[model samples]
Target: MTSDIFAEWLKRQGHLVFKTKSSYWYSQAARTFQAFPYHRVIEPDNNEINEFLKEHNGVALRYSTPLSAKYGKISYHVLFTQSTYSIEGLPKKARHDVRNGFKKAGVEPISFERLAVEGWELRLDTLIRQGRVRAETQSAWVKQCRSAQDLPGFETWGALVEGKLVAALIAFSGDDCCSILYQQSATDYLRFGINNVLTLAFTNEVLKRSDVSQIFYGLHSLDAPDSVDEYKFRMRYTASPVRQRVVFNPRLSPLFNPLTYSALNAVHKLLPGNPTFAKAEGMLRFSLQGKKPLAEQDWPLGLLEQKESILKQY
Candidate 1:
C-alpha cells in the first residue's frame, strides 16, 4: 500500500523507478516520468523538479496537481469519492445495467496467475475495440499480467459467465485509496453489461473498507476520445478537477514552446492517427493554457461543479 511497495512492483518488471520528496515516479514511453499511487495529488515545487531533472539529465515529468496550482495544464482525474457506494446510488440506466450484469456474470477476486492465462484474449479484444492494438503486443501483455502475480497491494478481480472469464480489472489498494489500473472485457458480452458489473463490484468492495476513502479510476486521457471517460461518468464516477503538468528539462523545455506546439498541432492533423504527435500537441496545449489566469481557463463544463471548495484551495 505504501509507495515503496508500488515502486518495488514496477522495478521487478524492469521499469526505472525514481523516488522524490513527494511521490514515486516511473519512466515510461518517450522518457517521461509518471508519478504513481495514481490517486495521490502531488504539487512538486520548482526546487524538487530541478533536483530530479539534474539527476536524470533529460526526461519529462507528469503528475496530477491541485487545481489551484500556479503552473500546469488543467486536467481531470476520474474518481469516485462518495462516502458510501451502492447500486442504489447509481443512476437509473446504470442501476439497470449493473443489475443485469450481475445476473449474467459472477464477479469475484481471482489469482493474478489465473488472470494472466485467461485474460490475454480479454486484453486483446479491449485494445482492438479501442483501436489501440499497437499499445501492447501479446508477449508484452502476458509479461505485464504475470509480473503482478505475487505483488502485495495488487488484486485481480474477474467477472465470469458460466466459468468463462468475461471481464476483469486490476486494482491497487493504498492506505486510504484504491486505484483501478486496468480493466478489460469481452466485446461480445458488451450487451450483457459485464464491464459495468465488474466496475461496480470492485468499486463497492473498496468502499466497504473503512480505511479506504476513494477509488481512483484514472486520469483523463490527453490523446484519447472523451467517450473514454464518459463511460466512467455514466458508471457514477465524477471528474475530479486537477492540473496535469508536463515538465521538461531546462535544455528541452524551449522546444515545447508556442511555436513548436502550433507546428505539431498542425502536423498531427495530416498525420491522422499518430499517437505520438497527438500527445505532444496535447502536452503543449495544456502547458500554454495553464499559464492563463484562473477564470480564463476553460472548466470541465457540466462534468465538474464549479463550487468554491472544488475550484479554489483556500
Candidate 2:
C-alpha cells in the first residue's frame, strides 16, 4: 500500500499519528481527540512560542503556564481589560497626571491619539524593527486588526515622545474587567520608564473610571512572562487562574466538555518534562529559530513568528 493508504489505514485502526512532513506520518498510538491537543504539541522552543504568542495575547498567555487537571485552571489568565463599566471620572484626568509624572522627572508627556488601524500598523513596524515579527507576519496582523476593531470593547491608547509614538496599548473592555491585548514601547524610551507611565495612565483613565474592577494582563508564560505581569502587579493587579484544556479526537469535537475533563485527569497523572509538558518549550524554539518571513502566499492567515533578532541586535 502507498504511504497515504497505509497512514489512512492506521488512522482507521484508531492509532493516533501526525504528519511530520508532506507525506510522512508517525504514531503516538492514541485514538481520542481528548488524547492530544494540537496546541500542546511541542515543536519549537519556548522563546519563539512566547514571541509568536505575543501577537495573539490571549492564546500565548493561555498555554504558557503550568497546566493542571483542575477544571478551574483551564484558562491560564484573565484581566479587567474588557470591562465596560464606564470609567467615568478618571481617564479625563490622565493628561494632567501624565504631565505631572513627566514634570517630576524633568520631561514632558508627548500626547498622541492612535486609531486602531494606525495602532496596528505602527505595532507591525515595531515588531519588525524589534525582530519579534517578520515583515510578512506583520501584514497578516494588520488584517487581523481590521477584523478585531469592529468587535465591541476593543480600544488602544499611547503616549508620544517629541511627537513620535513612544508607547501604546490595546485592550478589550467587557462587563466586569478589561483584557490588555498588546503593548509596545520604543527601546530608546525604556530608560524614561514610559511603560510605567503608560500603564498608570491606562488604569487611571480607562480602568479606574470605566467601573472596571481589575485589569487582566492576559497570560504569563516563560517568554516575557513577567514583563507584563510585573507591570500589572504593581498596579494593584493580582493573578487569577484562567483554565484551558487541549483535547484530541480523530474527529473534530463539536462539544469538548466531557472529554476535556477526562483529558485533564489523564494529563495530571503525567509529570513535568513529559512530551506534552514541553509544548511551550518546543513552540518557543520554533519561534526563535524560524525567523523566516511569511510567504505572501500565506497572507491574511499565516501564524505569527517569534525571534530574538532585534533584542540581540541591540
Candidate 3:
C-alpha cells in the first residue's frame, strides 16, 4: 500500500496521524531476513516504523496467536451494548450514580460528526503531554493509518470539551458487528470522566443503528496490572479472551526458540519497569495462570469450567 493513501485515509477518519518522509516500499527492499527474523517485536520509532513497513507491503498490523482447546483459552470480551444495558450483578443504583457523577463533572455525549480533525490533534497533544503515547507507538500508528486507508469499511466517533479534544474511539463496522480499533483521551479529561462518557456515547451511537448487533471491546488482558476491568464492567462491557501466539519459524533454525526465550527473560529482567512489557506479559500470564490448578480465590475469572470459552484467536 502506498503511504500517501494510508495517510489520507486516516486523516479522513479523523485520526491524529503524522506521516514520515520515507515510504514502505523503500524499507522492504532493505530487508535481509528470509520470511522470518529472530528479533522480538519492539516499538519502532516513527522513522523506523515507516521504514519497516516499506518492506512488509507498506502496511502495519497487529496479530495474536491461536491455541488448541486442550491447552485452554480465554474468550474475547464481546459486549452487546444494545442488550447489555445492565451488567450481570452491578447494582442499578450504582450505574445511575456514576452517570450522575459524570454529568456533574461536565461529561457530555458528542457525535462523530461533531468531533472535527482539529479536536483529534488537540487530544493527541494532551496525550503526549501526559506521556501516554510513546514516540514509537505514535509513529507506527501514523504509518498504520496510511496503510489502511483503502480498507473497505471503517467508522469512528469522538467527544470534545471546551473546543478541545478529550476522548475519541475508532472502529471498523462489518455486516453485523463493530470492532473497536483504538481509543484515546486526554489524561486531564479522563479525570473528568470523558473516557466513560465517550464510551457510553459511542455505544449509544451504535445501538441506535438496527444493523449493528454487538460491540467487540477487542481483547482484554487479565494480565493488566492497571486494572481497567472495573471500569470496562462499569460500561457494561464483559470480559473476554484474545489468544496470543509466539512461534519460531522452522527455517530460522532449531536454536531460535531457546535463544528467543532466553533473550526475552534477559530483557524483562533488564527492564522490569517497561509499561509495554508489563501489559504484554500481563495478558500472557493471565491466560496461562488460568489453566493451572489453583484455589478459588487465587483464580480471577472464577474457574475455566464456570464460564464459556474465553480463549480467542485474534
Candidate 4:
C-alpha cells in the first residue's frame, strides 16, 4: 500500500499524521509515535532523517522500515507468504495443532460494528490480566481497537465453542498485505489451542483473496521469550531481519543502548519471577531518556534494496 493510504488509516485511528522530506510520522501523543521513511521507493539521505528526528520529542521512537539498522540496532519479524500457509508446509506439530483446533469448531467472520463494546472490553481486560500484559499498553490497545472497529477494510473474526466466544482475531487489510493486529484467546480455555485454530482459519481465508500477497505478523525481537519464538517457527513463519532501531533521546542513550538493553533483558529472563524489577527497569529506561527525539543512526545505505530483492523469493 502507498504511504499516503497508510497515513490516512493511522489518522482515522486518532493519530496525528505529518510528513517530512524523508519520513511520514504518526503519533497519538507528544512523547510517542512511529515514523516510516520514504524508503519504499527511494533512499532517504542522512540530512532528511536527521531533520525528521529533530522535530519529535519522545522517550523512544520506533522506525518501521527494514532500514532501521542503519540508524541503530536491528530486530526481526515474521511475514508469511502464501506458500507458507499450505497444510503440507507446516511442521508436524503445528499441523497437528491446526487440525485439532479445527475439529473443535470453526472460525467465522464477525462484524466489529455489531460487537458490544462493553462485552469486548470485559473479555479483553480479562485476557490482559491473565496474560500479564502491561496495563498502559493494554489501555492503549483497547482505545485503538475501539476507535478502529468501524474503519473500512478492518476485519474481526472469532471461534465459538458451545456458543461462547473462545478466540478472536483482528486484521487490517491493505492493497497487497494484511496485518494481524491482535489475537487473543480466553484464559480459561487455553488448553483448546483456539489461537492457533483462529490463525489457521485466517490464513486460509486470506489465501482465497487474490488481492492479498502476504501477512505481517508484527515486530518480534530475537530476545523474545523462547516459547513465543518457537511457536512462530513451528507454524512455518520465517523471521525477516529488519534494521529496527529504537531511537532513544540523547539524554537516555547511556542507559538504553542495545548492549545495555540486551543485558537487562537477559537478567530479566534469568529472574522470571521478578515483576518488581521488570516494572522498575521499564520506568527507569523511559524516565532517563527524557523528552528528546530517539534517532537511529549508522544505517547502511543500499542494504534495504538488496534485502527486499532477496525477500521476494519467499
Pick by lDDT: which candidate is best? 1
Question: TM-scores for all candidates?
Answer: 0.91, 0.45, 0.56, 0.70
Cα misplacement distance, residue 259 of candidate 4 (Å): 11
- Kindly report which residue stretches of model 2 are placed more than 4 angstroms away from their true locations once superposed: 1-101, 104-136, 148-151, 222-225, 250-314
* Model 4 C-alpha lDDT per residue in residues 200-235, reported as the tens digit of each score: 778888878888888776654322243554555666
Residue 253 of model 2 has an lDDT of 29
Q: Tens-digit lDDT track for model 1 on 1-314?
A: 37778788788777899888988889876777788877778888988987887787646778889877887766788888887778888889888889989889999999888888889899989877775566666776677777777877889999999999999998888868888888998999988889889998888788779988888888877666676677798888988777887888777887778888878989988874666777677766766777776567655542446545555652
Q: Which portions of model 3 show Cα errors greater than 4 Å? A: 1-68, 71-75, 81-139, 142-152, 221-226, 241-243, 256-263, 272-314
Displacement of residue 121 (Cα, Å) in model 2 is 8.1
Residue 164 of model 3, lDDT score: 61
Highest TM-score: give the candidate number: 1
Model 2 TM-score? 0.45
Question: Pairing residues by index, what is the TM-score of model 4?
Answer: 0.70
Off by over 4 Å in 4: 1-9, 28-30, 36-44, 64-71, 114-131, 136-142, 221-226, 249-314
Between prediction 3 and prediction 4, the one with superior TM-score is 4
